[model samples]
Target chain A: MVRVAAHNIISPLGCTSQENFDKVVAGQSGIALRKKGELSDTDFQAALLNMEVLKDKISGIANAEAYTKLEQLCILSLNEVLDGVDVKSERTGFIFSTTKGNITEITNNPHAVDALLATTANKIANYFGFKSSPQVISNACISGLAAFVIGRRYIDAGKYDNVIILGADILSKFIVSGFQSFQSLSPEPCKPFDANRDGLTLGEGVASVVLSKADNTNKACVEVVSGAISNDANHISGPSRTGEGLYRAITRTVGANEEVDCICAHGTATPYNDDMESHAISRAGYETIPVSGLKGYFGHTLGAAGVIESIISILAMQNNVVIGTKGTVEQGVVAPVNVTKENIQKPVNGLLKLMSGFGGCNAAVYFKKHGE
Target chain B: MVAMLLFILKSMENNQIIKEVSIEHGKVLINQSEFFTGETSDLGPFLKSLYKQLNLKYNKYFKMDHLSKLGFLASEVLLLNEGIANETDEVAIILANASSSLHTDVKYQESIADIPSPSVFVYTLPNIVIGEISIRNKFYGEHMFFVQPSYNKEELLDYTTCLFNSTPCKYAIVGWVEVNRNGDYSAKLMLCQNKK
Candidate 1:
């Protein structure tokens, strides 16, 4: 692994646009009762954030598309995250994670090729002039978390010692249409793991982390201890009805010296997804671990999920608290898996985070307090 | 100074110079598949079989999704058949070229213009091919994809080596893959190793 500094996190919560997240964490769900796109109030209770707000709060981004919504988010975040840091001298690198990348960029520009979607990270590295090779990781919803895992490994490898892990995506007509068409979008705020849970609400946002070799002076720092990524491979788009991916991610992530007292999951509240996750969590044997899902709070960021949620998990572990499952109630998915409702108070020396995406991609991460 | 440790290899049954290290050529295109078949690792045997079933040669290579197909083929040839090693640190797949995947991208995007299809939406991103490769090959190095108008050695090396040096990986898959409307797509790769 390359040498690296501690990781820092920024979110719609305390970092930047956190006010919105605070409201959700306070037990107020964002899923509105109105209708747009393909969602109806009867199908899914909806929770969504305002894109105008998302656009307003972002730094150094113009909502432009050099390649896709995902590619732009990376630039906007990197410009800010690396503002004080030097990638040129440090040869800082990037590891990008997204389940779905900038699929929208191709349409506006006719004559596009398939390779364009796969080149998002390359565009950023080339634009910023960072020579350290950049890499991409996609493991369904866990894609972002995998990116962070790679960043840490770079440090462990005695490489440049600094890496930028970025997770981002804009809800394109492409993704929204697909889910809505699939009848996966909730009409109201998404009720994750709730007995009345209908479906998920899709939203857009980009989150970033700069993992460096040296100690960063930033207050919002967390050290990643261990992580695991696995594929259920049972189904393509549909998650293993058995939650096999979730179980493996958890089982694979537990390290001997590390302990996970809490978990953050890909609780999209979709009927099938919720049920599969419930079974998977039980199998992981962490029935009592405090669990939460950002989907209720942030909606599903799709391609940007892994990195965005991993940063959120790092923040939760670093703060020693578990954010509520914002819109959860009644335990719709299953029991045993302790879904957090109220912001729980605890001394979290370690934490676990997990996500599963299409293609049976699943991943888990374990974080612990770094030495001062 | 950096003039050291170049290996002389004659390691295959054919003694066909299976591996050779040189900065002189710096870039070479090797086929991981058999001499004629364009098989690859990322898409696995399924895609290889798919190609074979269609009797697809390089003729349709351009017509297929550029990122998906190029990722499978380029990665195989670029990795020198070693496949992505577990020891790699911060590996990024950086490709430079003139036209990005304009054709395939536009078609996929239009299908989901009103609403995206989940299957087609997966490959919409410019760097997704690399992600697919990294995910399948388990290459957790740095993940990045870039589009340049053309190849420039100094700029390419400056950007590429700095990327290699930024991470711990001694080797990197750096190159360009582009598709022409005439159903022509070509790729060039370098297995970059850092100087001690």
Candidate 2:
């Protein structure tokens, strides 16, 4: 089995880890406002963290124009998480995940972006000197999680010593407008798992986690015992009412005997997404796992959600705590899922993270207590 | 075993695509042979027709989706009738790299840009091309796409081997699918399975 370790938190310099932790655990949020395209609401914002604050922290790495804001976050976050570690081993493989892989570049030049977009994953491998062959996966919102699951397969196949799974995304006009078109963006902070939630706020951010054969003492973490990805084969944009793909993934990874402690729901806060995620979690028999979502605090970081939330889950697990769903104080919306609102601190055995995306693809990843 | 590998390698030196069609002015120039897609539905009918012209029929294949159905359809035709399925024993899905779903991407984005439409925003992605094909032919084999300045033999063989070794799909479905701005398109797929 591939072991996953606790995660390191390194957002923009101004976006402190402790602050991120506090906001998450206290159920507060940092989502800023945004509006473009057909979206009528102008009052809502996203989790707009400033990268300019970290300029002093990251210097000397050669960058490309092709490397948009998301790529910039990737380099910074990767450096923070792997401070002393060297990624020179040929046995190390990279699986870069993102919904819009450098699509911002495309907004500038469609012809070039169309050609360069596919190479963004490999660019990281080349940049970091990773020896193992790299792979790219873009399953819409679940892309990053899918990358993590694929990394598990690679480790299972004994094809790599470690997997560098990075999820990055930036709030460009392209992404913001796209979400706005769907009428999915919340005018206010997202109220995931909350009854009165209106919509979600799309944000900009990136998160990186290094999965290796190493132990917990090696990193800040959890162990990835099982993971699975399946397609609903139902609706393209809408999630399966029965949570078909999600159910299969959870059952396959957690198995019949084990029980999950806390769950990281997709929690896009959209009507359909929240409902779908809640249904899937309950279907996985996680009715009372102190379920929560990060969208309220970080906004919907799209591709970054998988890696970012995985990092959040790892950190919470490492600290023997469970973060509550932010901005879900008033139960006004209809939700079949359980929401952990109060500050719940408990020692958990395993953490299950689930994501659903376009192409009807969905993935569920299970991380257990390290050294198990 | 080494000698056999060498013999196979020597034979691959003669590998090449039989047909390369460029859709200029909405008319297809097979350059070598005539081919493309015939049907359409939730997917793109206009583009699927191109794929029907390129793909030759096979017993195993996945149904087309709005995004990749067209590209898969064309690549399927190129693969079956003129490209590699009939000519070689081993095949590889090495797409010189093209949009998995450009039409869908454009449509989806428009919903967000002009109208509030999440249904349309659902399909803006790239891998829809290869995924559609994998399902169509049950081609859970060695497959990958390379974005390069142009095709290079060294790059192709090296990439193919890396792809083959990464997973367990014996036959590889590989080539390039570029939908030009002029509404013209050209794609080529080849099978690179071991004969020995």
Candidate 3:
């Protein structure tokens, strides 16, 4: 089985997975209201990384100024997870996931090659001196989880013994302005699944996880049992009212008789998204499972949401706790779900991560504690 | 392992190339036969003329950015050549490209100078083409969009094999679709199905 060997998260909350988990478990939020004329004329609510701190972290690397902020964040997260890992081996592969990489570069020159997602991925992969060509997944918001699915399959197919997956996207005027055009940005911090939930808040982050085929039967680890991707065929920008795609993806990933102890949902806190997730969870018979959305803390990290949230879920499983939905106050949706509002101390052996994106794409990854 | 074997066997049994379509250099090819040829300088007029020649009535085609239009046209021709009415919703779309949506991203970036056009802003994502195709074909199955420096058929085929083995996907439209601001573009799509 494909298993997680190590993971890291670099966000506003902290640099390492454990650090972010501790802050999140303490109910500390990284989100704040800010007015940056370069990003938007009006004040916006988002979870932004402290640039000075990030600069200090990036300063340790050689020729750090040459790399973009997004690339620097990716390097930082990947470095934390690559301790003693053989990334130079021919059997090791790299996969980068992002919605937009260096998108702000386009503001300077629309034709800038650095603005291309593939270019950014290649630059980072080459920086790590990886032997093989890096693969990139850019399927909107689901890119992070989809990368895991692809990595697991590659290992299962004997194409690689290990795969390093990195998902990163930095906030920019290009991104914020686009959301502002759609008016999807909430004036306040997002309240996912809450009756008063208005809209989603944008955030930036980078996350990394190493998947390996080496068995760790005696040790505590998380195994990727299965994963599936499905399209809603409903709308490009809006989620399906019926939640058809997400429901099918969940059922396909979990299959029959596999227990899922908790769910890490793609709760962007948008009314349509949260409602759609509730319906999908209920339809898949997982309504009673302890479910929570991490966007409140991370402010919808887009491409980083899946990997960062998945790593946090794995941490929760390891610690035997269910992290609460940060900004949610009262349960509100068309269907019923056991949304965890406060940290619950319990054994979480199985976790299912769900993400839906702009392409009518929905992905689910089921992970189980090794030897559970 | 058994699923992988099943996938291999299935490929050997019925994964025939049903239809192939390629659009590049102001020309369209079906199974390597020229279907349409136009001016290569600008893709806008060429795409519009091709749409007219194909007698497609989908108005949404005009709204898509160049990348999606390229992919959409390729898919439309591929499915049209297959001569089937989308028998199943399990048709998967596995697409890869180098430029992603940079062609349209550039345009959207230009629009940001004025007012961010919500219509144009929505198509900035690479996977929006997949969504457009899904909406057009009513396909409610698995789909993924990959970005590489160039087309890597072997990797895409491997991922498609895994999908066929692990999920309920019965067919797939896989290939490369790329577009850039310089009007350099290409779309080569093939339809494959696991025949019973």
Give me the displacement of residue A12 in model 3, in angstroms. Answer: 0.5
lDDT of 3 by residue, A252-309 (tens): 7896888899999999988999999999999998879999899999998989889999
Docking class of 1: incorrect
Q: How accurate is candidate 3 locally (lDDT)?
A: 0.87
Candidate 1: give its CA RMSD in angstroms.
8.2
**Per-candidate DockQ versus the true complex?**
0.13, 0.17, 0.59
TM-score of chain A of 1: 0.83
* Per-candidate clash tally: 87, 59, 0
**Winner by DockQ:** 3
Model 2, range B60-112, lDDT digits (tens) per residue? 23334343544565554445453333222134455544353454554444444
Docking class of 2: incorrect
Q: What is the C-alpha lDDT of each candidate?
A: 0.57, 0.60, 0.87
- Pairing residues by index, what is the TM-score of model 3? 0.95
Question: Compared with the true structure, what per-residue lDDT tens digits does model 2 show for residues A29-107?
Answer: 6565544332233445766666567666545457544455556566666766564445776566676666666665444
lDDT, residue A83, model 2: 48
B80-196: candidate 1 lDDT, tens digit per residue: 456546523334454544444454545555665354555565444445455555544555444444444454434344444444433344555666655543434556665655553
Show where candidate 2 strays beyond 4 Å: A5-19, A34-43, A58-67, A83-86, A113-115, A215-221, A330-336, B1-67, B71-120, B127-196
Query: What value does DockQ give for candidate 3?
Result: 0.59
